[model samples]
Target chain A: MKLLEDRIKKDGQVLPGDVLKVDNFLNHQVDPDLMFAMGEEFARLFQDEKITKVLTVESSGIAPAILTGLQLHVPVVFARKHKSLTLVNDLYTSTVYSYTKKVSNEISISKRFLDADDRVLIIDDFLANGQAVMGLIDICEQAQAKIEGVGIVIEKTFQRGHELIAEHGIRLESLAKIAALEDGKVVFEKQNN
Target chain B: MKLLEDRIKKDGQVLPGDVLKVDNFLNHQVDPDLMFAMGEEFARLFQDEKITKVLTVESSGIAPAILTGLQLHVPVVFARKHKSLTLVNDLYTSTVYSYTKKVSNEISISKRFLDADDRVLIIDDFLANGQAVMGLIDICEQAQAKIEGVGIVIEKTFQRGHELIAEHGIRLESLAKIAALEDGKVVFEKQNN
Candidate 1:
């Protein structure tokens, strides 16, 4: 977590309207070593939950989720933003509104991949307003799957995402929690440990 | 490679119109152990290239590309299919037509991540018609980066993708070379080695 926090401090760009650009090591461009380390940390945090599957949205979340899957020895399922030809039917779909993109995307996962007997761990790159995480949680509920916990690479603690997941009674862990972005700088939350 | 081929034969579904649905392992729901093995194989194949970066498109390609980056100890950059708010300018963009999706996507990579001094290895989940791979190659050319080779998880040898890369004079290595889909079965090309 310290590694991520440090890297964020060094490279994370704070833009207007609460935009933190981490494309250098996350989002667009990725650091596989950092992803692996984060995955190991997530595995360590949720090792006791008996997670059967790691679920995430497409594009950004795939990298970290797959690495977490590698560490936990579980299958990684990514919900597609676009409805491809092969993925037309038998899907659990949810609509998520993105404040940054200013659009609502219909995220879907094939029903065959998730089921009632599975324990799911949701992972994502960032949790801003919690719409995306809530969408994944919606899919999990549709499949009647047990929600184990949520792991986030970077979280904005000033946002409502934290409280939303907490409202669902699901344990949430973030590698780097940004307390606030003040005067073009990132303020991290105090670590409990 | 044998492990991948075996898994493909077991779990890969050959749909209508030469479509091989590998969502069970390689696409939608991913098996991270197999991905790590494929990544290791790719790393071994391009070990001498001194790869500074691994490039691929978003979503499906992220899993293997990140794993490959992990093995090679380099950063992985995934071209975004959809332009987000933060990634609007200073990009190396190319248009790629997806036969499966029947759409042309303008994929772009931030100019900040790639440079002329970088040695890049392009990795992707599937090489069907080679449009996606060609798009990445175009971006690499724009960046003036040295492309060491291309690594594919599954290559339809019967398609034009292999020949297209060959025509570009780029070395390509596919973990599974699919020969044909006959009578709802996946027939892999005979391995030379």
Candidate 2:
């Protein structure tokens, strides 16, 4: 977590509209070592949850989720933003609005991947308003799977994501929690530990 | 590679329109141990290429690419299929046609991540017509990066992907090379080794 916080301080760029760009090593371009470490941390945090599957959204969330799957020795399943013609099975669908992309897209996971018996661990890169994770949670509920925990890499705690997940009585853990970004500087909440 | 081929034979579904679904363990739901094996195999196959970065498109390609990056101890950068407002600078863009989605989309990589001095290895889930890899190759060309090789989890040799990549004079290695899928049964090409 310290490594991620330090890296964010060094290379993360803050644009207007609460955008924190970690493309140099987190979003577009990824640091595998750091990401793997973060994944291990997630596994450690949720070690007792008996997680059966790792779920995430496509694109940005795939990196940490795949690494976490490796650490937990579980299968990683990512919801697709686009519907493929090849995918003809009954899918559990949930709609998520992306403020960054300025579009609302339906995310889906094949029914074959999730079921009532699954203990799902949701993972993602960044948490803003928690809309994406909420969508994932919606899909999990549709499959009747137990939500073991949610792991996020960087969280904007100021965006009401923390309160939303807490209100749902779901456990949430993030590697780096950003309280605010002012004048290209990141503000961190006091370490909960 | 043997493990991958075996898994494909066991779990891969061959559908009409040349669709071979390994989503059970490769695409939609990823088996970490098997994916790690494939990544290690890729590292071994291209170990001498001195690859500085691993590149792929988003969604399905991220799993293997991230694993490959872990084994190689390099950064992994995925091209975004859609432009985001966060992306404000010039990008290395290429248009790729997806038979699965029935859409042609332009994939772009931020110019900040790739450079002329980098040696890039492109990784992907499957190769049917080589459109995705070709699009990645175009981006690499735009960045003026030297391409070490292309790594694919499964290659449908019955398609023109093999020939197209071969014609480009870039080294390509596929874990499972299917010669054909007749009568819902997969036929594998002779292993080059």
Candidate 3:
């Protein structure tokens, strides 16, 4: 977590609208070693929980989810944001509004992949307004799967994401939480004990 | 390679219209153990090459690319299909036509991620018509980076992907190459000694 926070400070760019750009190592251009380290941290954080599967959205979350799945020795089921021809008809679909893209898109996972017997750990790269997390949670609910916990690599603490996850009483662990972006500088939240 | 070929034969679904769906282990729902093995295989295949970086498109390719980067101890840079608010203006972009989705989308990699000094190894899930790989090669060209090779998990030999890749004069390694998909059965191409 310290390593992630340090890397964010070193390379992360702060844009207007509270956007933190971590393309150098986090999202667009991923550092696999750092990703694995983050995965290990998530594994340590959720070691007690009975996590049968790691759930995440496509694109950005796939790297961390795969790494987390490797560390936890669990399967990763990534929800596809765009509907592809390969996708089966039996699926649990949820629509999420992306603040970044300013478009509402449907994210879905096959019913065959998730079920009531599994304990799901939802993972994602950024947790801003919690719309993506909420969509995953909705899918889990539809599948009747148990929500083990949620693991986030970077979170905007100033946003309402943490509050919503807390409202659900789900254990949420974020490696780096940004408190504010003032004058193009990232101010991180004090480490939560 | 045998392990991967076996996996393809076992779990891979041969759908109508030459589609081999291995979403259970390769893409949608990823098996981390198998993914790690595939990554190790990719490392073995490209061990001789001077791979400065591993490149792939986002979503499906991120898992294998991460594993490949882990084995090679290099960073993985995934080209993002969808643009976010945080993406910088300077980028290496290319258009790719998806046969499955029937859509032409632009894939971009931040200019900061790649440079003329970098030797990139492109990794991906499936090599069908080679549109995606071509787009990746285009990005590498724009970045003035040398492409060492293209590593594909599954290659449909019946398709034109292999020929297109060969035309680029880059080494192509596919773990499992299917000669034909006859009557919902996978017929693997015989390995040449």
lDDT of 2: 0.90
Where does model 2 exceed 4 Å of error? A83-89, B83-89
Please write out the lDDT profile of model 2 over residues A25-80, one tens digit for every residue: 98889999998899899999999999999999988898899889999999999988
**Candidate 3: what lDDT?**
0.91
- The interface root-mean-square deviation of each model, in the order shown, is 0.5, 0.7, 0.7
Worst 10 residues of 3 chain A by lDDT: A80-89
The 10-residue segment with the lowest total lDDT in model 2 chain B: B82-91
What's model 2's lDDT at A193? 62
Worst 10 residues of 1 chain A by lDDT: A80-89
Q: What does candidate 1's lDDT look like per residue over A1-193, in tens digits?
A: 8999999999999999888999999998899999999999999999999999999999899999999999999999999885334455798998899888688888999999999999999999999899999999999999999999999999999999999999999999999999999989999999887
Docking quality category of candidate 2 according to DockQ thresholds: high
Candidate 1 vs candidate 2, DockQ winner = 1
RMSD in angstroms, all models?
A: 1.8, 2.0, 2.2
lDDT of each: 0.93, 0.90, 0.91
Of candidate 3 chain B, the 10-residue stretch with the lowest lDDT total is B80-89
lDDT of 1 by residue, B1-193 (tens): 9999999988999999999999999999999999999999999999999999999998799999999999999999999885334456798899899898788888999999999999999999999999999999999999999999999999999999999999999999999999999999999898676
Runs with alpha carbons beyond 4 Å of true place in candidate 1: A83-89, B83-89
